[model samples]
Target: MPGPKSNLIDLEILDGMPDGIALVRVDGSIIHMNAALRHMCGVPDEPGEPLKLESLAVPDNIAQWRRFFTHAAEDGGPMSFDATISRASDKFTFYAEVSFHRKSLHGEPVIVATIRNMSRHRKIEEALRLEESRLEALLRLNQMTGEPINRICDFALEEAVRLTGSRIGYLAFYDEEQEKLTMHAWSAQGVKECRISNRTIEYPIKNTGLWGEAVRQRRPVITNDYNAPSPYKKGLPPGHVRLERHMNVPIMDDGRIVVVAGVGNKPEPYDIRDVRELVLLMEGMWRLLQRKQSEDQLKMSLAEKEVLLKEIHHRVKNNLQIVSSLISLQSEVATPENMTAAFKESQDRIRSMAMIHERLYRARDLAKVDFGEYLRNLTSYLKSSYQPRTAEVQIDVQNIMLDIDRAIPCGLIVNELVSNAFKYAFPDGRRGTLEISMRKDENGILLVVADDGPGLPPGIDVSNTPTLGLQLVHALVGQLDGELALHREKGARFEIRFK
Candidate 1:
């Protein structure tokens, strides 16, 4: 029921719209069309000419358009559908979205439709979704640090095949040390002839094929038609599956090709996007492999160094034992009492040092020694050295570990103090007991060497004593950064504390 003015305004608005507009009679015959629609249909805007929907639609879509018009008339509501329109050139088709509405214009029943091309928009949306998937795959690859290389390659191949719609794919790693390429993992879906059963495959030394071309070029290569004749063409071997289309991506490390990933037999031609995605995943996996290799080399070097250090300790202990034997021979020839005592003391000191190396050779950690075990052995040796003596030696030391710098000084101090007690504390061969105890407390380590014998003489100060043994003890205590005290209560007692 629109007036003349209103109808004119509606026609003007329809002609100016970006989308194509057309009006058809209920019988499916075109009554009027805007300039956009006339351009889409590729016909002149004649006033009285016969134009039908069937003439504009592609032959395959003619039936679909008939069904759509029937449904729109029956439903009498706004309806939308997708269809292809034949272009005037007849060389290409246009994908479009068409919306239909039943309207009454100038007392005539007609179908109004607006058509918009959707091909470009569809491509844009698909690209966006593809980019999102690529980013997610990259993130998953980054989180796979410390995983085995085979597992990483398997994951990468699976994603590549899925994204590229490929029938089969594989990842191969190059060993620079060995100068060869080994296939680590492969993925095959719905491919019966090319199914891979082996865990790994070693390429021939003189590799000649599409894969070799990628390595030689040091870049990505895509072949839409593998069967085409060319100089780079190398046919598949016997029992090998056929390849229709293929893409190869090489991963580089320090200007050398370290890995190559390839996909084959896609339903369509492979494009740049496929190459980009595969390269991204392969590059990440290559970095992880490099890091793992470096770590393995470092561990091997450390093991070699440890073996060398243990051998050095063993030889040093043997050399010290030889020195101790020389001192014993010299003491046997000495007739003077003072000379014999001096030789004996020197022998004991050398043996004490030799014991430290012996313990180190036996220990799992070469840097520290079990001081308690060392003291036990030292006390036994001292008792044997003072043969025919009636004094009994007792040890009550805790199991503590000390480094070489502290253990050597501590061992010498114990030797000097205990030897003095056995020699002078009990005169006339009187029976007595020498006690040695060492413990660690919050303050520091405490060492006590005491004897149940005649105590030191009155007014005798150990700090100022002129005896070599006492002076040596004072000097060792100072080197340890410790405090020393002498207690004369029915026995001689010396205590020292240090960290």
Candidate 2:
């Protein structure tokens, strides 16, 4: 609407402006458009019929735009505002800030408008906001401990679906060796939208199609166009939620896939960003599950150790009482030699019980002890206790192991019998040999302590014997539900057998 003489000058000035520029009437018809403004609104290059400014606007934004023009026409002042603009027939759309001033050209009221696109700035802000949300979700997941794995997996899947703009999702545990899947979780929205009840909870790798491609190929699978025909496309289950677009990623540990997670029905096409989000969430979830399993195992082991400790404390208390009784008995002995001997016997008995606990504390497997190793240590101690003896102690024991209950009594019985050998069988420093042998015999054990010296007195009823050593051996053998027999051969041979 500029004069003909100044039209070229005004046109040149408008074209030189960086911001989009347009001249319009209050009725919404365009008077003029600069090249920048024409491109912003998706205008055609060729000149044609006069264009209406309303035609270039989004349909839903027309009402606000009309109001903006009305205010500009009446106020006769510069005005500014922000809104969304789009060409309805195309995919062109952007957030824009519009500044305008009412003017008069050739005595007709006109409006000069300038547009500054803000779409890129808004997108960057939204991306940062989403990234913050993802970090916060990961922090919460890492804090989860001792929770049921299904609950943790479900939480992770829900976040994956929400953060990726998907409406449905599932998490399945994969067994690489078996090439199978165990359905672990389904998002809450997925369950509600899916009308299929008692859905298939497992599937073999070979039987799966598109979604399983992520697992088969060991990478992410994205289907931006769900209806695109392909051999991998399979029919959905009856009453299952419909899908327009889908994405999934495989979670890998070492070189094998450990989990498969799938999401579907995103509003926009799935992209690499969605794949990255799902991968991070699923990996963190796997770590949380592993930590929970380890915590459960540690709790169970602590419980078992507590029970074992109680049993050990009980055994130690009983042994201490027996030691007290032995000291009392030694005090009643009338001879110094007999008292010294009684004291030595008591020291060996205490050491026997102490040795069992010491070995248990150091053992890899706390439930059983190496009986042969225990006997060897015991014999070495006894030989050192009975000094100045030339008798050779020959031992033949197998690699038999026994639990603490059996080991304690069996060790005490061996102590009493072997001590008796060094004391009575080898008098006058008898230059002979004492033999000890133990072996497993058909669901029972055989223990023998023989000395090549004078044998036990004839008609000695071990069951009614008044000697403390024989009495203790009888009691301990009875505790094991075993029997003791004395064979008078080249020496006194005591054989004890028990299951």
lDDT tens digits, residue span 271-362, model 2: 99999899988899988887888888788778877888888778778778867876676566537767666677778888988898788778
Q: Which residue pairs show collisions in model 2?
A: none
Indicate the worst ten consecutive residues by lDDT in candidate 2.
1-10
Clashing pairs counted in every model: 0, 0
- lDDT by residue for model 1 over 1-499, one digit each (tens)? 1223236677778888888887777788776677787677566766355677656678988888888888776777978888888765443677888877888877776788777877788778778987788778777876776677777777778888887878888888777667678877768552357643543378753565766778777789998998887687666665566778889888888888788899988997899888887888778677766777787667776785587677776756755664566466445556676896777888788788889878976876667899999999998888788762878888999999997768877988899888888788778988989999999999999999999888878877878975666776787789799999988886999999999
Which residue pairs collide, candidate 1?
none
TM-score of each: 0.53, 0.67
After the best TM-score superposition of candidate 2, give how far the Cα of residue 364 lies from its true spot, in angstroms. 8.4
> Judged by lDDT, which candidate is best?
2
